[model samples]
Target: MRTIHTTSEEETCEAGKIIAAELRVGDVVLIDGPLGAGKTAFVRGLAEGLGADPRNVSSPTFTILQQYRGSMPLYHADLYRLAPAEVADLGLEETGLDGILAVEWPDRWTARPTVAYLVVIDDQGGDDRRIRIRR
Candidate 1:
């Protein structure tokens, strides 16, 4: 487990890029944070680090899932607007089989991968944030 602190969105993104270096295909990352905790910003960094266009990354809250082709692939999911029971229909684990999976609002996912990295972000007011990564 590791903890990182950031005072701006850019720093938060950098933290995500740092974590991306340690990821591999078939890996799941569960991200838990408040609505404005910079979860999407962190994912943008992930996309950039993985050779994808960061500008193409966006919150998938309405779309449910978005796939990006990077050095490998990135399957990003947001369950913010979905009911917990609806999560299974997406088959997230299989969707991310060929790449890394990053899920926001993962607590709504009852069948989330047991072996996965957990990222918790706490908003410390203004642009500051405290991010904790656990395996």
Candidate 2:
């Protein structure tokens, strides 16, 4: 497990970029955090580190899933609005088979990957955040 403290959104994103170096194709990252916890910022860094344009990354809360072209591929999903039963219909397992999958509000995902990186973000008031990552 690894823990990082960030006092700004940029720092949180940098942490994500640092962790991105350790990821590979077919990797699943489950991200859990409260509202406005900089989850999207972290994922923006992930996209940038994986060779994608960070400007193109955004929260998929309404769209559900967003795909980006990178060195491999980035399939970002936001399961906030879905019930656990609805998650399977998205075919996330298949979508993640060829790229790195990052899922926000992953508690709704019932078919979680057997092996995955779990990222938890805790808001510490103001712009401070504590991010914990583990496999």
Candidate 3:
């Protein structure tokens, strides 16, 4: 595990870019953070690093999931509004079958990937965020 303190949005996004550089196809990343945390910004950076257009990445909170193509494919999912019982209906695990699945509010899901990367972001009361990454 590695922990990083990001003082601003740019730093938070950079952290995501760093992670993206190391990602592989079929990777599942569990992301947990509160509202207004930089999860979406992080995903934007990740999209850029993976050779996709960062401007197109957004929180899939309402839509549930969004897909983008780059060096590989990226499947971003938001579980913030879903309950564990509803997760299976979405078949989210299959997101890893063809792309990198970055799931926000992953705790709402009952099952986890056998192997997964994780990123936890905590807002530190201001422009700062505590970001932890683990595999």
Candidate 4:
């Protein structure tokens, strides 16, 4: 387990970049946070770190899953709206193969991935966040 503190969004995203640099294919990153807690911002840095176009990374609130190509392909999943069974229907196992997966709102699912990095965002005072990472 590891932890990081950030006073602003940029710092949070930068931290994500650092973490992203350590990622490999088949890596699963599960992000847990309340609304506006910088989950998406972290992923933006992750995309940038992976040599992907950061502009192409966006919240997949509607589509549920998005794919991006860079040094390695990235599979971004948002499970905020789906039920556990529905999430299973998407076949996470398949999507995670040959790519890196960054998932938001993974609470609905009961099963865990083979290797997953957990990011918990704790909101402190204004613009302050405590980001904890565990694998």
Candidate 5:
């Protein structure tokens, strides 16, 4: 486990980029944070690192999942609006068969992730986030 203090959103995104550089296909990144904690910003950095179109990545709160093709496929899932059981119904583990999965609000899902890069976002100060990355 590693804890990092990010003084700004750019630092938060840079942290995500570092993680993204280490990521390979079929990786599952679990992100937990409160509203406006830079979860989506982190995803944007992940998308950029994966060689995906960062501008295209957005909060998939309504859609549940969004797929992007890059060096490796990236499947972004948002469980914010779904219950645990409902999230299970989406078959995340199965979808993870092929591409790398970046999940926000992963606590809404009941199943244990086999290999998870857990990222916890903490509000340190105004526009600052303290992100802890645990393997």
Candidate 6:
């Protein structure tokens, strides 16, 4: 595991970009963070790094999941509102074959991807955040 500190939203996004560069198709990124913890900000940078518009990236908390085309596809999923049993109906496995999956609140899911990158964001109070990454 590794840790990074970000004092601003841009820095958080920049950290996401760094992480994104290391991603490949079939990669799964598991993110555990509280609301306002900059999870979406990280995804925006990830989308940007993959050649997609960062502005187009948003939390899929309401819609469940979203796909963005880039150098490769980005499958962003949010399981905040889902129950464990309902997670399977989303057909998340199919997304893994064709794009990178970045899942928020992955702890809610009973099954996880075979190979996943674990990222935990800890709010350091104010605007600072500590992002911990592991694979």
lDDT digits (tens) for residues 76-114 of candidate 5:
898988999899889998885676899999989889495
Collision pairs in model 6 = none
For all candidates, what are the clash counts?
A: 0, 0, 0, 0, 0, 0
Q: What tens-digit string does per-residue lDDT give for candidate 4 at 61-102?
A: 579998888899988888889999998898887786897889
List model 1 lDDT by residue over 5-116, tens digit each.
9999899889989988999988898999999898998898888888888898898646889988899898889899988889978887588888889999999899998799
TM-score of each: 0.97, 0.96, 0.94, 0.94, 0.93, 0.95
Q: Runs in model 2 with CA error above 4 Å?
A: none
Clash count for candidate 2 is: 0
lDDT of 2 at 113: 82
Task: Using lDDT, rank the candidates from best to worst.
Answer: 2, 1, 6, 3, 4, 5
Model 2, 1-135: lDDT tens digits are 999999998998898899889998899999999988988899998998899999988876479999989888998998988999899899898987788999999899888885899999999999889999998
Per-residue lDDT of model 3, residues 22-91, tens digit only:
9988899888899989989889888888989988888764689888889899888888888899987898
Cα lDDT, model 5, residue 131: 88
Relative to the true structure, how large is the alpha-carbon lDDT of every model? 0.90, 0.90, 0.87, 0.86, 0.85, 0.89
Tell me the alpha-carbon RMSD of every candidate.
Answer: 0.9, 1.0, 1.2, 1.2, 1.3, 1.1
Candidate 6's residue-wise lDDT over 36-117, tens digit each?
A: 8999898888899999889888876479998888999998898999998899888887775787999988987777875799
Candidate 5: Cα lDDT at 105: 93
Off by over 4 Å in 5: none
**Candidate 6 least-lDDT 10 residues:** 107-116
Cand. 4 Cα-lDDT: 0.86
